[model samples]
Target: MMAIRDATAMRAAVADSWHRSAAAGVLAEDSCAPVTVTGDQLRDLRDAHPLARVFPLLDDVLGQAARDCDAIMAVSDEVGQLLWLCGAPSAMRRAERIGFVEGSNWDERLAGTNAPGLALRLGRPTSIVAAEHFRHSVKQWSCAATPIHDPIDSRLLGVLDVTGGDAIVVPQTMGMVRAAARLAESELARELLVPSRPDPGTGRGRIAVECLGRHELLLSVDDGWGQRGQVRLSPRHSEIFLLLASAPRGLSGDELAVLLYEEDGGSSTLRAELKRLRDLLGEDLLVSRPYRITADVTGDWLAVEAQLAAGDVAGAVRAYRGPMLPRSTAPGVTRLREGLADQLRSAVLHSAQPDLLSTWTRSVWGADDYDMWVRLRDLLPTGSPLLALAEGQIGRLDREIGL
Candidate 1:
């Protein structure tokens, strides 16, 4: 009791201390203790979310210390309890629902009220210090959240949160929350890419490879985990992944062997690579093939175009996750990058929705597309007010790094 009071009192007196503590990496150093919720209560929250299917991983994360770092780490839906358990154990277990995940009206109904919630609402990453929260209940809590984008469609997947108790309102836990959110994102990328059933709602076909997470987790999907973790692809294996993901109609073994640099063009190595890819991803990765190395970028482009013509906005967006052959480190990839960027720009120009258009604009950034984007922004109806209001955003981009 005294410890809690002293901590609280000291925190309030020199609230700035929390910021210092956070900057010093205090949270990472501490072993998180338990906070109150029961397994059953958590189970109840789990039942309320579609994501409950993945709650085991949530539990596994909170079971680690980033929890007690001054706050709790949790996952929630747009409305109501999803997985509300402790990053730490203790106190009591109350059947509680965080406001962030408590109803439809996304884009602020729940999100505008709090940190994690607001980040989700904005569909952008955000951080909130004490008093920044729009809701009274969450105002005292400091938070950091990142909007998790879908691996395939790049849609707003959800928000990953690290919330601090009182002291969290200070700045100390920022890094922890950001890191946790990133882990959540990496896992999301892994799930979307590494073998699984494809949801038609996503823009990609039954076997699409997201080019965004390419350098991130897809490295593992190919061979070495890169910074995302221990993905096992060697440099050669990486070449194979890019080919398959980029293939419009799926390649044959001979093509794959060429792509993989199989000396004799024997089907064996190509077949083996496919098997490994299948193991990492699920069986549906192959469109139809014995497997091919020579990806007909042109032949496969038809399917991608069909996605666009079919009015698949998400698919159009998904198709842009690129620099062409992402893993190759090849000089030839630049042309592919420029082509995809222009294509995405044209697609966004025609889209009816401002939000989607806004994302499209941000997705491809550079001098080449600068004037085109400026024109597109002007094209937005005067009545079509956007988050950045369309007019000013390009200037913001121009002032910053090229990308």
Candidate 2:
């Protein structure tokens, strides 16, 4: 068994992962990874996974190198279920001992910290060295993994990992893993370009504008190939995207200026910003006259609204990440932000679902919301252990407000 190091001595990511793992009840000693899917069920899952479209490319890119290095390559879906594993027979057998076999879940919460799970969690390339792993059983292995994103929606598709000994943790292996993931994404992009391919959803192309709780917005757009890519927009551009997406019919220059500026924003300034936004998005995506995105646009904030409209208060609570663009003071964004927060808060309070109210009150925007804390305190049944915690919070708030 490998010796466990103190959390303070580990790398920040690994330490944080260790903390989460422990919180999830993962044993520091050893725990078997649960094989959550198998046989027909596993087959169905693999076929439905987005990465299934580019499995061949992943194999062609990582297979030979894994065998050459006496390592094993594993592909996991977004949820960390091992969809496939390939390598030399010896390497495969070695990995199987630690529950790295196909169909076994390697999510950090399930199997303790690992490269694939951490990469999926952070959405980036990550490496886990011996002993850095949370489980003693997995400490002998080292691995490099990178998360793969869908080429059509920029949603996380899966993770590609190479697991072996010290050799796998080297920078070169990390680079190769990242490259393979990118190659898999490119292959997915090419397949979408097939003219005969059936449209999956939103035939006009889908645009996801992410701005809730974020100062800078991330615009995820489909490139007409049914493939998607993301770009970080400047704060001003982010505000524009939010406003335009909110008004599908479009917003005139004067209307936009009023929403964008505190006072007297010149037409040239708005035009320059619009032109730069146009440059970033291309001419066709952003049409002139009345500025609007010429695609099926949806914002994160809008998703919450849709959920609430559908009467899924729990779903709405889950979808509401935080106040929209919390740092933005722009008139339009501020109104949208407050309206969204108010709507969700009202729905959650009305539903009086203790769990939903708890989630809202725990959020940064709701933390200081006295009404929500009061609701949570009242809604929790008497003698429920959580009731005391809720009451404690109310007492704290009372003192803060001098009530």
Candidate 3:
């Protein structure tokens, strides 16, 4: 109470967080009510989120540390939405009473000043002991948390938290959470560094391309000295590479120009773009009787397509990052994006597991998809937290479409 009264005397981070929460109109005596998403919606959010990629690694580290302790391990996305929670049954039950469950929105603005929320807000490790929390209801608990970042770009990925009674306030607990976060970041970095296996008989070393969200090209020699860095492609380069990779026979300059620019210009523009691409990729890697990549490149989009072809709807959804070159308006790129999106959307709508449908609806590409949201809303159990989200979206969609 004294700390709350004289927040200036508190640790700078905690004091700042408290001040921010108050300015955001968070009431100290509020119930700290949870705004949660549950059931299929919860499962979907977890599956599609990039943070999901690190869960297995995080579980291996923090799960062991949490055993037999009163503390629980919680992970939240960059926005401070709780994604996963693990701990003793009794501890979990206690947590639930305070609405600290999976899929709950716990950002400082919503949940008041606390460790996970403050850690995310401050972009650093933080701790909040009992009586320091802005919400009176949460003051009985203590928590330590650290922000996790994407190793490649150093962008905040999520927050890792350990929460319990006063035990969580100890320095050792804060250290443990920070170490666990570092291990997770290391795992993410290692994944990016490793190259996928080369296609047989390609004879051009290991080639991997990511065209799902961003464009990245990686080539590793067969001699085991893999390239230490990746080449990022411009939008035009990405479009050209995707087309050439899809059609091994390749296209003539005129055909390529039409597909890329939506009109027939002479081969001059095509030649210039090709020249730039050649400079970025070695000249030998791109051949020109008809424009084509000399080597086979296994792409993230191709992997997703293969997974869908194998009737692995869940796997396909997992592989899909977003619409290919979402900002590109090239005719061929637009066709490919629409075709792939329609195919994946059909598969998810028709045969995806309930959880997968939820994921698709929550995804950036599918969030505005009305039919999927309707389907998910119907499938969710009555009174589920996600039902509200689906309903809200449906209502907005109804207004937009004049339904």
Candidate 4:
């Protein structure tokens, strides 16, 4: 087992990984690079990949094993994109803080020196311990991983990783992950021999609308080939789309007119706008008689709401980009904007993790939020690096309020 406290004592392979990570310009203190794929793009990648066939087996093996330990078992494709992660709920949450979730890229170029990335790079079993990790954000973690190869041709398939605290670097845990990787390879070989079933969800259009910040719409069609392009929306069309997205049960034209124009007088204008919107997004996507989005559409605001509802406040904060349609003054849009901002602010101020609070304080929205700053200041440890920023904000607030 490699020692976490001393880097000079590391094995030659581990030292070489650190050199490669440095050459890639990966910052030691920075968070992992931003997610490479999300939403529809991620779904399509997962569905089309050969590894998807072995997910159930991986889950059965890793999920059961992880329950008794404070670790997570992660599978990543050859390029180091995470395909699946399962572990103790608490450990999963901790991992997410540094962007270890599914669909994230953990390539050495992206996440710096880590077990999975290095194992894949070296084509062998590897271990990365605390402080040995190139990223400071992940120094608290240690992991062991091994590469899985295609059984027939011995082509590199992916990597299987077991990540946790200090226990991860222990010889027994390292051997266990290696054994699991071999088992996964055997399962994948068997699965490849059988004809695969068609995914029912394939070829379906996925519509994602973003109401936070600027209003935008993304329509991805699978077409049984692969995911395709996005359709941009006019601001007015985006407004209508948001209203319809909110009321999934459907909203009458009159009700929509009132929300859009704040009076019954603009029913004609509403109808005209609806006609144009229908022309842009296929008629089937926008059902008439009652104004509602017929196709499955997910909004960024809805993502935040869902995370909040699921009691994952950190996830909710991560999902919330900004206020809903920052430029829209439509009565309905304004209501949603304020309501969402208020709910998120309250949630964060009440129960946010310290790291999340630090993240919020750096944002434009929270930079001037005196109350949140006060709470964050109180929660921060004395002499912490962020204390100065929190104090500065509080002082600015005091001057503004003439305290």
- Please report the candidate that would top TM-score against the real structure: 3
> For residue 253, what is the lDDT in candidate 1?
73
Report the lDDT tens digits of candidate 2 across residue range 88-167: 78989877878789988787866789999999889899999998888888888999999998675576778999999876
TM-score of 2: 0.56
Residues 49-145, candidate 1: write the lDDT tens digits. Answer: 4355444665566425444553556565432122443554321121123332222122331123344545654566567666544334444456666
For lDDT, candidate 2 versus 4, the one ahead is 2
What tens digits encode model 3's per-residue C-alpha lDDT throughout 1-403? 2235777678877788887676544567666445556787578778877778888777788865775577789998766779899887888888887788887877776577898988877788888898778888888899989999878646577899988886556688888888989998888888877875643443464457777755343333232233324676777787888778777888888778878886666677779889998887776578898988776568888889999999989789878877877788879888988999999999998873656776676565786899898888788787554565567678778988999
Better of 1 and 2 by lDDT: 2
Ranking by lDDT: 2, 3, 4, 1
> Which prediction has more favorable TM-score, 2 or 3?
3
Q: Which lDDT tens digits does candidate 4 get at residues 282-305?
A: 665677878777777777789898
Kindly state the number of residue pairs that clash in model 2. 2
TM-scores of all candidate predictions against the true structure: 0.43, 0.56, 0.67, 0.50
Ranking by TM-score: 3, 2, 4, 1
Better of 2 and 4 by TM-score: 2
Better of 3 and 4 by TM-score: 3
- Score candidate 3 by lDDT: 0.76
Q: Estimate candidate 2's RMSD in Å.
A: 8.1
